[model samples]
Target chain A: MDSVVFEGIGKRYRSLWALRGVDAAFRQGEVVMVIGPNGSGKTTLIKCLLGLVRPSEGTVRVNGQLVGSDPAYRQRIGYMPQISQFPPALTIGQLLEMMRDIRGLDAETVDDTLVGALGLDRQLEKRLSTLSGGTCQKVSAVLAFRSRPSILVMDEPTAGLDPLSARTVLDQAAALRSNGGTVLITSHLLEEVETLADRVAYIEDGRLRFLLPVKEILQRSGATRLAQALPVMLSNSATP
Target chain B: MTKVYKYTLVDLARNRFVLAFAVLMLVLAEGLFRIEGDAMKAMLSLVQVTLALVPLVTLVFTIVYSYDTQEFTQLLAVQPIRRSAILAGRLAAIATAVLMALAFGLGLPLLVHLPGMVSLLLFAANALLVLVFVALGTLLALTQRDKARGVGIGLVTWFLFVLVYDALLMALMFALSDRPIEPWVVPLAALNPIDLARIAVMLRVDLAAMMGYSGAVYQRFFGSAQGILLALGLMVLWAAWPALVAFRVFRRKDL
Candidate 1:
């Protein structure tokens, strides 16, 4: 079953089209990478899927239910926002504990797994505001991944991570897909997407321009590097 | 509903600054009561100020907190919990926190001066005011979506209630000096929550004389059982309107 479905979804801010008639879907266990230049509605598309922005036209659904009709739809998904701010005084441990409590999950086991996965046991007591950007991203990643949500919607998830942390997160994403979880990730790191994504969906000017298998993209662009392939893909599909 | 309420209470309790502020307000209230020999008079004045100002301040706090916690709210929205539950949780948390603060600020003063019915009335009035303001604040915060603008609007509304509303009433009275104070005018005072609270408490203390002509008018009309009932109804409306408006906005909002 498709974990996400969008049919003719569009969002407008005043006179500007943030997104226009975007049709897409992601099935369970698939890793879909969304790539676009700035103002190409990459973030807008994600927001609409997450029910953060109501599409002015068409429908958005998660697991076949309308986005607005059911709040429970959110529980099945984990979202990592591009820019997230934590309460200034909360420690990493406190943050995790609070989310767990709010979600009504047992803290002991989840805390143990989170600490092991992120190697954050040492920084558990450190205040969120004091943490570096990379550390904060790690905390966010843990929060998104902790519950083992069925669907993960991450925006720029690996932006600030150190190389090792980035690799760990990517590995986790792969593992999640293997376990039948759906992952929809957006990032400027084309090389990372090339390494992890099973399918790539390129959007331009608020409209979806390309949806192709990763291998197909690599073959068509005739480039061994994703960095080399990205320009080729964009230039070929520059027209709306 | 209980989970939302419980979470709100817990979050409010964890905020050190708010807790400290509540403590400070309680101390001030206690000191003021001790300094003033007439307990009823002191309590009445203090309740007036608290009802008008605390709600406004609480509203500002709610807006700032909401803006600061935007990411948290986004995460919460994705949770399986209902959107209404999320909003209710935040509102309940803020209202409970502010109510605690108001209790500390006004509770001691009432206890020191008029410890029984007067204290209870003051507490009830304070609670109503807190709910009304929190609801108002949430609506304003959701509507404005900007911390500075929301806070500014909250402060202006506070000023109007705490100072300008009464001043305008007095000016109106002065302007109508030539006409007799009508029975209907007494009910108009109920339009302002602060005014109705003042009337209710002052009537209890037998200090209606302090209000001059307005006092006389109130005694002649709403001074009886029906008048009190009407005043209470108006107060309920004051608290209800903002809450309903806020709930409507939150239900439709993207985040």
Candidate 2:
């Protein structure tokens, strides 16, 4: 199966360690929710995978190719950052055109299915800064999924999104996962995680604390649901 | 890479500040022409603006613009584009934008007035000014994160080049007045892009009239076609040096 392998990944910024000797894999055709508290190296891990931030130690491989050595590897993975900030003056149309141009794809060849679903056609003329947070998140969604990448790494995908738009975004991501694509999502919203994540990787203090299926997490915690089980698991892990 | 350049150029070319700059240049150049009634005199005034305002505007504008495009850079960074391409493309975009503004701004008025060589040399000098400053701005922006401090350094850089450096040269000239400082003055001045461009123009137009003894010294070394070629070559080197530095920083930078 296709997988992104993190082999003893370590990242250090001066004296502070962001990720330490961590080994993990985001395997294909599954929605893997990476859950962690704030500043738990979640963003750092994502950046390392994208090759935006170089790792202090170890290597990251996407489909067995080093992410750093291969720019083409990035084409297979679509990434959506936590914040959906773009150039303030740029219109959505212009941005999409630039993206399409950069991707070396023609209009007819490009798949902007998410754009149509989100009703972004009317808002295409609007400047980026004018959009509400939810709408901006939607634009980010389109950019991520429109390219039809095999893997999607979304950092806090629906943080500022409205319930309805968030549903659309989640549904689009889920659709991508069901179509033999791998998805890696990080979010504080456990309810969404429960609905979407097939397996959850609990990260804390720059290490993968626990990784288990949602059902197993619930069963082991002696709780009926993942929401209730998460606290129990956290307490047990802390004691251990 | 070409795609990045195309969009960056187009996007920046249509920016309001670029348009405003162009309009302001037209107004200033035309007004100077009307007031002085001599194209040569008007060009001298324009040269001062080019030396002072061009560097500051290009440096500050490029730095601020670089910070503004951070998000866009992120968007591109995740793509199949190389980091060097991303940095170089953006730098080229900004240089192209600023050059276009200066061209249209000054070109609208002075194109019809100045002699062909003088007009072309003037434009070349200004273009080099834009390239050099933008490259420096790129390096500064890559190294420094704080916008206020970055902008502050940019302002100080302008002040150093436009005012302080010249003042220091004047002091050096005074101290070594009897020591054949003539040789040192021109060589030292060549280090600054502004000084190099200023000499390039002064040699072409009126060197002896405006510059007194120092002018004669410069005219002797930089008076010939070979000297002019060398000066222009140095100006190109000035642009290339900072651009190379920025590219190196950009490649190693963590987004």
CA-lDDT, candidates in order: 0.78, 0.83
Which clashing pairs does model 2 show?
Answer: none
Ten-residue stretch with the least lDDT total in model 1 chain A:
A107-116
Pairs of residues at least 3 apart in sequence or in different chains that clash in candidate 1: none
Q: Per-residue alpha-carbon lDDT of model 2 for A119-212, expressed as tens digits? A: 8988899987688887888888888887888889998888887787788888988998888898999998888767888888887888878778
Worst 10 residues of 2 chain B by lDDT: B205-214
TM-score of every prediction relative to native: 0.91, 0.95
**C-alpha RMSD between model 2 and the true structure:** 2.0
Fraction of native Cα contacts reproduced by each candidate: 0.48, 0.55
Model 2 residue A216 CA deviation in Å: 2.4
True contacts reproduced, candidate 1 = 0.48
TM-scores computed on chain B for all candidates: 0.89, 0.96
Clashes of 1: 0
Docking class of 2: medium
Complex DockQ per candidate: 0.53, 0.61
TM-score of chain A considered alone, across all candidate predictions = 0.94, 0.94
